[model samples]
Target: MSNTIVANDLRKRYGDVNAVDGVSLTVEAGEFFGILGPNGAGKTTTLEIIEGLRQADAGEISVFGQSPWPRNPALLPRMGVQLQASAFFERLTAREQLRTFGSLYGVPGRKADEMLEVVGLSDKADTQVEKLSGGQAQRLSIACALVHEPELVFLDEPTAALDPQARRNLWDVLRAINTDGRTVVLTTHYMDEAEVLCDRVAIMDHGRILRSGAPAALVRGLEAAARVSVASGVMNADEARTLPGADEVTDDEVSLTISTRDAPKVVAALAERGALEGVQIKGATLEDVFLDLTGREYRA
Candidate 1:
């Protein structure tokens, strides 16, 4: 597949701080690519650079084989952007807002209505923007972005404040967009969201990408054994430390991290000691891989 977005050694700075430092990535056409990181990790900065909203201090960026710089009007019409924060006229209805944006994009009236329906906001079309709930407002924003029938879409934390049901609804909409052959690039802090929605993900930290790959492949690469978590009294860290292939035991939690090869032996040992009580075995998840790579540091 041809790459729709490409960045090489991308660098951006704010005063002395490097907001995006030596970042490089390629997103294929029609791919659901996710950029993930904690707050202040440069995910938004990198996205803005590729969207032609911010100037890069160094390196190169291309979207749809063209530089996303100096305000390329030809490229702008083919791209859709749903920013993390959006504002709408307080008195404008959902339909009105969509119409306004569609007019700006030179989209037909029917196209605006179609996008509103696609985002599941048709019922609320007549409701004022200020009267709509947070989720409804968000859906309206998404509708506006798609009104132009863009080939490439950028969504930053699209589901951040949505309820579970709303988030699920948005996921379905995104899936349909991808099925229609539009490339999507999204930034999110939710690991589960990335695991479920992205065909591929790039994990960013400290202004750089630590890893990029399919979510399942990244988890499988860890090769860690099933994790066993027991109640506090069943076993202690010291006891778990003595088990075969056990590497590290989190203090006082009875959580054991063992090698995949020796997982059976470790289970047998626990069973023999009657310490299997409350023990639960689980496979590795994206969160596990994230913690392993990024540690448990608190990012502001």
Candidate 2:
């Protein structure tokens, strides 16, 4: 696939710290990419610089093989951005807000209405922006961003504080957007969201990208194996560690967590010992991989 974005040694500095230091990555066309990091990490800074909202202190960036440095006006038309907190005129209705935004690109009213339906906001097309729910408002923000039908779209913390159902609804909308062949670059602290929505992800911390790949691939690269946990009914935790492929066993009052390279062997042994009642065989997750690479847990 052709590369849509290529950033090389991108750096940004604040008073005494480098918010983004020597970051480099490439995003392919039609790919759903995600950037994952904690607060104060360089993820947001890197994203903003790529979006051309902030100038880099050093290095180069290109979107669709053209320079985005210094915030190109022509580039703006071919890319859409939905900031963390999208603002809208309270008095304007959803349809009016989209129309106003579309006018910036010389797009007509019909385009705005079509976008509202695309984001499932058509039912409330006449509702004032201030009266819309949080999810509705965010959907409208996304609709406005797509007024020009850009090829590349950037979404920053797309589901920051919405309820479970609202978040799921937005995920569906984003998936639909991607299905139409638009490249989506997402930044979110929610690991589950990235695991579900992104085809590939880059984990960043302390102004650098620690790792980048498919979510499942990154997790599979961890040295830690799947966990085979069961209630410590009759088998001693230490004895259970002697099972084939079992590396370590952590025991509590009622349960034992077996870290095993071969879960089948450990589970069968536990079952033979009549200790499989409360067993749970769980696999590694993106959070686990991130914690292993960064030496820290990802906190929202």
Instruction: Give the TM-scores of the predictions, in the order they appear.
Output: 0.87, 0.91
Model 2 reaches what TM-score against the true structure? Answer: 0.91
* Global lDDT of each candidate: 0.87, 0.90
Q: Which whole-number lDDT from 0 to 100 does residue 103 have in model 2?
A: 95
Give the runs in model 2 whose Cα sits over 4 Å from its true position: 231-244, 247-256, 297-300
Question: What lDDT is reached at residue 19 by model 1?
Answer: 88
Where model 1 places Cα greater than 4 Å from the true spot, the runs are 229-261, 264-280
- Which clashing pairs does model 2 show? none
Pick out the ten consecutive residues of candidate 1 with the lowest summed lDDT: 251-260
lDDT of 1 by residue, 93-198 (tens): 8998999999998888877888888988889988999998888888888888889999999999999989998888888998998899999999987888889989
| Predicted structure 1: lDDT | 0.87
Clashes of each: 0, 0
